[model samples]
Target: MPPLRTAFDALARLRDARAFHPKGARVDGELTTLDAGPWPLPAGSAQVAARLSKGAGVPDGFRDVLGLAVRVPLETGPWDLTFSTIGSLTRILPFPARGWCDASYSSLAPYRVGGQLRWLLARAARDQPKVDASLRAARRLVRGGGFELVLSSATAIGVPQPIARLRLHTVCDDAGQPTFDPMLNHPPGVTLYPDWLTKARELAYAGSRAGRA
Candidate 1:
């Protein structure tokens, strides 16, 4: 995986930002657990730090894949849930999104939650406004009321069930934002499965950190 790491490092250095989702806005948020599907998310609210970005960094007025990284301070540790707009459930490919509304997101890979493989998803809540694909819009959107998302968890052959509501609060500067990495910062019972995939993902993030740091 040395070549993969090197390639990611080069890409990050070339862009002068993250290897992927180079441009983004940071936001302070809160996650309210509602009849949760997993432990640690059962019956309480948690302070959340999040990043919203475009996967390809496409310019405004254009469609691009959207990304969201949410960090919740769990009792076990910080859990980062990163999501991206996916085209389909077959292979979980990345798809372009027009804006904040109607954009679908998924973790792309299953995680072992309570000894069962689960897919996490997020979508704009029904009472959302039309927020465009730009950093400024994200800032304005959050300041106004922010994006309310319906958190969902699904099994391999089952439908995604609504588990919680994640509400973004205020915009924050990126200067002090933590590099969200679930591979290293996940809680005790939540684990990324399929060893090879995790290793590759970890290496990519490591390279990004080294390049962007």
Candidate 2:
């Protein structure tokens, strides 16, 4: 759990360093869900895309950043993300179908199996140290499944300074009940690209650094 929290914090801090506008640029577009597409490789893997409304004036660099590649497991459902700009009247910008997001990076699951095994093993290990039963069950369960990455965002309202919240939910369809990526259980220590948290962290950090300098 602590490791996951640390990773989230690192990701958030990374985003903050990049500095993105919360209200984002003026982007008019429709939001819709999509299935994974081809040409990106691993053909048949699910994917989603957002098409901005014409003449919306999205930043080219931001768009390029957002267009970065991401990967998710096969069992998970389609990805959904929201976008908004700084000083925008709308509190929430649902990127339902339109991909107004400025920056993007691929979401990868490197420890799906190992993490699952460790979690399951922890439960039994608490009861007994040397047990073959737990090991057997862990092996069987972790052998066949994977995880998913769902992207979403929120606005950080109120004083102290207004900001937006960008969230990514990691899910696994092993038992049909989706478990949010354990990563989001707490406020990330750092922010990643295209994430609202990133922008806020940058502002806060800059102010602190300036005061010291």
Provide TM-scores for the models. Answer: 0.93, 0.18
| Top of the candidates by lDDT | 1
- Model 1 scores a C-alpha lDDT of 0.83
Candidate 1: tens digits of C-alpha lDDT, residues 1-213? 498888889899999999999988989888998867564673688888999988889888888888899998876778888998876544267788777766789888888877788888888899899878777777788889777999898888878888889999888874576788878888776777677888999999989888886
TM for candidate 2 is 0.18
Candidate 2 Cα RMSD (Å): 21.5
**Candidate 2, residues 53-167: lDDT per residue as tens digits?**
1122233322221211122222333322222222123332312112222212222111122112100000111112221112122122223231112222221333211111111
lDDT of 2 at 207: 40
Candidate 2's displacement at residue 104, Å, is 13
Q: Cα RMSDs of all predictions?
A: 1.7, 21.5
**Candidate 1: clashing pairs of residues:** none
Highest TM-score model number: 1
Off by over 4 Å in 2: 14-26, 31-65, 68-213
